[model samples]
Target: MRIDKWLWYARVTKSRSLAQKLATGGHVRVNKDKISSASKTVKTGDVLTIALERRILVLKVVALGKRRGPYEEARLLYEDLSPPPPPKKHAEPAVAVRDAGAGRPTKRDRRKLDAWRNDT
Candidate 1:
C-alpha cells in the first residue's frame, strides 16, 4: 500500500494531506532514507522512521489495512519498533525575520521578492 495511505489507515496521521506534507518535507523515512511522496509503496516488515514534533517514531509494518478502520483495528497495522525519542532538549523556536524597511509589502514588492527567491 502507499505509504501515506497506510499511515492514514493505520491512524498514524490525522489526514492524508498532513501525511503527504510530512513526507514531502523529508520528515518521514522508510528504513532510514527520507521519503517525499504519498504514493511510495510499503509492505509488511518494512521499517518506517517518522519524525514528529520533538520525537522520532520507529515502526514495523505488521499488516496492511485494506481500508480505513476503527482506531483499535488500525492500531493492529503496525508495531512500534522503538520507543519514541526523548523530547528535543529545551530548543527555542526559531524567530521569524521581518524586512527592516518594509511597511507591509505591496503586490509588486511581493512579485519581485518571489522572482528573486525563485531565481536560484
Candidate 2:
C-alpha cells in the first residue's frame, strides 16, 4: 500500500493530502530511510517515523486498511512506539489564599484603623 494511504488509514494524518505532503516534504521515514514520494510502498512490520507540526510519531505498520475508519479501527493498523510528551508549563504560579476579611479594608474599617493609630 502507498505510504500516504497507509498513514491516512492508520490515522496518523487527518487527510490523504496532508499525508502526501508529509512524505514528500521529507517528514516521514520508513525503517530509518527518508521517503521522498507519497506513493512509496509500505508493508506489514515496516516501521514509520513521522514528524508532525507539534510532535513526532513512530508507528509500525500492522495492516493495510481498506478505508478511512473510526479511531478504534484505525488504531489497530499500527503499533505506536513514540515517546511521551514533556510536561506542560504554566504562565504563573498558583494563586495565594487569604483569610476572610483579609482582602481589602472598607471605608469604615479604614476610619477605625485611623482612629486607633491616632489614639496610640
User: Pick by TM-score: which candidate is best?
Assistant: 2
The prediction achieving the highest lDDT against the true structure is: 2
Over 1-120, each residue of candidate 2 has an lDDT whose tens digit, in order, gives 999999888888889999899999999999999989999999999999999989999999888999999999999999999999999887753433336879787798778877876776
Residues 22-115 of candidate 1: C-alpha lDDT, one tens digit per residue:
8888888998878878789999999999888867889999999889899999989999987845676876535334578868877987788678
Clashing pairs in 1: none
TM-score against truth, every candidate: 0.67, 0.74
Each model's lDDT comes to 0.84, 0.90
Clash count, predicted structure 1: 0
Candidate 1 similarity to native, TM-score: 0.67
Provide the RMSD of all predictions against the true structure, rounded to 1 decimal: 12.3, 7.1
